[model samples]
Target: MASDPFDRPNRNSSSFILVGVPSLETSPICLGILFCSGYIITLVGNGGVLLVIGLDNSLRDPVHCFLGMLAVIDVVMVTTIVPKMLSVFWLNSTQISYMACFVQMFLVHSTTSEESGVLLAMAVDRYVAICHPLRYQAILNRQTIAQIGLAIVVRALLFMDPLTGMVTKLPYCHSHVVPHSYCEHMAIAKLACANPRPSGLYSVAGSSLIVGMDMAFIAVSYGMILKTVLGKKSCWKAFSTCGCHICVILLFYVPGIVSIYAQQFGSGISVHAQVLLADLYLTLPTVLNPIVYSMRTKQIRQAVLKMLFSRKVHA
Candidate 1:
């Protein structure tokens, strides 16, 4: 009797379990602990950011309005990737159905693009507030913010749709072991039987369009912010307003640029090392963003403390 491909071990069939790969070095127990800790911290921190913004009426201004959106985007970004990654780690299974993998990839890319758009919106908000103070209130109304948010969501969805289609069309010839914890687009593209050059090019071009445009807008906004701040007499106040944003901008951009270069050009680093770095890039912003805003923004800090106290008293 002839054996089914699924019955044979590592037969390069469309089995749900992508087999024939060496397991990662980390113990499942240790990986589980770390992953859980990261997830909890990310959730708590981003949740706090949302709560503080929503409850504190004073933070409903244009600048914080954008900050709140940024926090929401971060929450989506972390939630999309981290939980699935933890499952992959703890279960010790690198297997994902082609459809499931494409979905995950789509969500990750969508959230990432949304985040970039939010950052760009925030920078524009800052520019209006600082550089065009006379027209700030008139220009950055609630309706405008709502429109920006909608635009971000729509743009992210559209930008990622092409890559998702490309990935799903590619033939998977049984070598489905994803080296990373998550179903990264590039990693999956590498495993396809057909030439993924077109997908690769599209991915790179999309990244350039999104990241490049965002960075350029942020740069121009900050340039005007810098000029306005330096021209003002209250230098300290101006610096304080922009300080948290500056930290977040650096946190978001530096790792992103490095990862792009590493993936595209660097050869000295191992894939495992690159994977670890990518994990860091994914996690650090979620962990640090709330801390930056809470510690730096006195209003948010006081609001958080008041909310905690109120909760305790109610309890």
Candidate 2:
């Protein structure tokens, strides 16, 4: 009680059990294979993006830098949750130690919050490029970009630190069985012997203030970008520049909002459907982010293609 259990976990059992996709009980093998394929695709795509960006000196613009950052975020995000989910499905090994659960929940939440901030930063980069093209380089130089990255990291750390403390301090008593596929704040907190209301409230507040503010900033940035490029050709080009990022944003945030709302308010949707939505929110972006960026951004595609071609030539 004096110090948090996160200093060391005290648990009812040796490990917590994850009841992953109860709906897949009849077809666990197939579901596991599907998820494994998804995870592999995500790795290959994002890895390729990172490789392309790192190899090309000409592609070192702020946009490319952010793309690499996003790829890293997507990679880490999937790595945090998907492996355990796959293990649960394939190996029937659902028991995760409390410390492991704590680590997973921390990485998952922090990376998610950081990615939201990165999305806002990307919007700002686009706004500068479209509206203040002449000043874009001066405004978003390497130092400035580094500063933005640092700020995003610190913001994520500060925002999620309290939530981690709240979730970790609670005494988990008899029930160590988490109903979900992976360790999340609510899932872990519900196992606590003490009240879990504060953890839930903290999560809701974190989503509203952290994610909500980032979305608001991105929206305002895009609005200004639209005004700056209102003419026929300018409008097309400007929107073209940001089109991929917009799609990625929508993919990342919209499903999460819908899933949260459905879970909270939509009585008509089934529990399994809600869980599926939650899973998709994390996995969908990882799978599609590279495709959307590489296809829409010509420079990225060219860079990736050139690198692959050279590798094949040397081999």
Candidate 3:
């Protein structure tokens, strides 16, 4: 007989069982296959971008710098959860140590916040390139890019640490069976015997403050870029340069916001649906961002082709 997770002793040291998507319970093999495939695509796609960027000197610029950062974050974001998710599906190994759960929770949330910051930075890069083309080099120099990257990391760590800390301090005597695949903040928090309101409130507030501010800044940056390029003869060219970034932004944010809101307020939403949405929110962008960039950006396409052909010749 499959033992009930609740049958385990209620101790802070007890491992949490990640139930994964209850709707997909009967299809664990299928789900595992899907996750495995997505993880491969994410690794190959993002890893290809990073490789091409490293090999091609001409690809080094402010925009590519941010793309590289985004790819790194995407790889981390998916890797943090997908392996454990696969274990749950394939081996029925749903148990996650208490410390490991908190670590996963922190990494997932921090990487997400950092990705948002990178997107905002990319938006500013586009705005500068389009609106002040001459000053673009001056504004987004190597030093400035480094500083921006540092700021993004620092901000995520600062905000997410407190949220994770708040959750860790909560007493978890209620239940340790997390409904979703991996350790999401609220899912873990809801397991606590004590009131999780403070942690929940901090999560909502912190996410809103960071994501909302990043979205607002990105919007304003794009607005100015549009205003500057509206009547110019080079308008089409400028728009083309930003098209890939815009698509990447939408891919990352749209599903994410939907999943987050649906999880938070959609009372009637099924756990299966919510879990699927969350999985998509995390995995989709990582898999698609490199493909979109390769298709849309001529330089990346050319560089990638060049790298592949060179390797082929060597082989």
Candidate 4:
């Protein structure tokens, strides 16, 4: 009679090994350089946005408020994953303790949820600004934005707690090798000796709900924004208002959705390609958001220029 492979004795599964893009293992230095460069840009770009918006009272409007919140979330998302990834890429430090692995999983997923929530809130802000220009101030004032931000954080943690908790409770008697850069939930779940379908289903359902609802709302918001703008004589100007946010929305959702599903079901795709997509999905948006906003939104562009000019004078 055949026996269960999972029941067989094996080496220590106390800590999981993260094999970050196995194809790139031989070129660790190149991968290290790429991630290091991206991490630096993400930090400087998002940090500059936060700093500029904080110091400039003129940039304290609701749109900029949401942008600042997004900057904070981007910083959290990248910081949670990038340093560990650098260690794996550069120093060959790939083992992550069980507790530490779950912590990273929680942070990565929770921050992704928070970013989605912030994007939804920003979509609403755009809707109000374009569709109800007169009521924009009363609709998304300081207090309301604060409440929304609080809700975003609370909802993200509350939703992610159960998912991570379930994965943590799983008996990981199987191989402790994770095939991705960070402690991605499903990647870890698949390593458990027990059936991982329940956790996988929950993760898929939760992710689908968050992404679906947020994308639907954003689409509807833009639809209404488009309708309102087209009726006006200054349609071009109105559309220009949403240009940066639209670009940001595309950057956030498109790659993310593709990478997630590819990891889950794209058997035809190579694991290395899947890992690369996931890594880029986690990172590219953070590096691009500030640059996109700076180029598209006049107010932010001016504020950033002003900050740089003043710094030059001080120098």
How do the predictions measure up, each by TM-score? 0.86, 0.90, 0.92, 0.91
TM-score of 4: 0.91
- Tens digit per residue, CA lDDT, model 2, 1-315: 487332345454767888787566667788788778889999999998888888788899998998889889989999999999989888988889878998998988788888898889888988898889999999999999999999989988897889899988888765677767888677677678898887777777777788689989999999899898787577887676567667878888877766655644456867667667678878888898888765568898887788889989999
The top-ranked prediction according to TM-score is: 3
Best by lDDT: 3
TM-score, predicted candidate 1 vs. hidden true structure: 0.86
Question: What CA RMSD would you report for each candidate?
Answer: 3.7, 5.3, 2.3, 3.7
Model 1 residue pairs with clashes: none
Candidate 3 stretches with Cα past 4 Å from truth are: 1-3, 6-9, 231-244
Q: Give the alpha-carbon lDDT of every model.
A: 0.74, 0.82, 0.85, 0.84
Rank ordering of all candidates by TM-score, starting from the highest: 3, 4, 2, 1
lDDT of residue 142 for candidate 2: 97
Off by over 4 Å in 2: 1-11, 237-244, 260-269
Q: Weakest 10 consecutive residues, lDDT, candidate 1? A: 13-22
Residue 112 deviation, candidate 2, in Å? 0.6
Error of 3 at 1 (Å): 10
Q: Of models 1 and 3, which has the larger lDDT?
A: 3
Q: Mind giving the per-residue lDDT tens digits that candidate 3 earns over 1-315? A: 877644664576568889989767889999999989999999999998898889899998898999899999999999999999999999989899999999999999999999999989988987888778899999999999999999999999999888988999988876678889989888888888888878887777788788789989998998788789888997787676566667767777776676666665556778888788778878887888777654466788899888889989999
Local accuracy of candidate 1 as per-residue lDDT tens digits, 233-270: 86777676667777777777666656555665557877
Cα RMSD for candidate 4?
3.7
Distance (Å) between predicted and true CA of 208, model 2?
A: 1.0
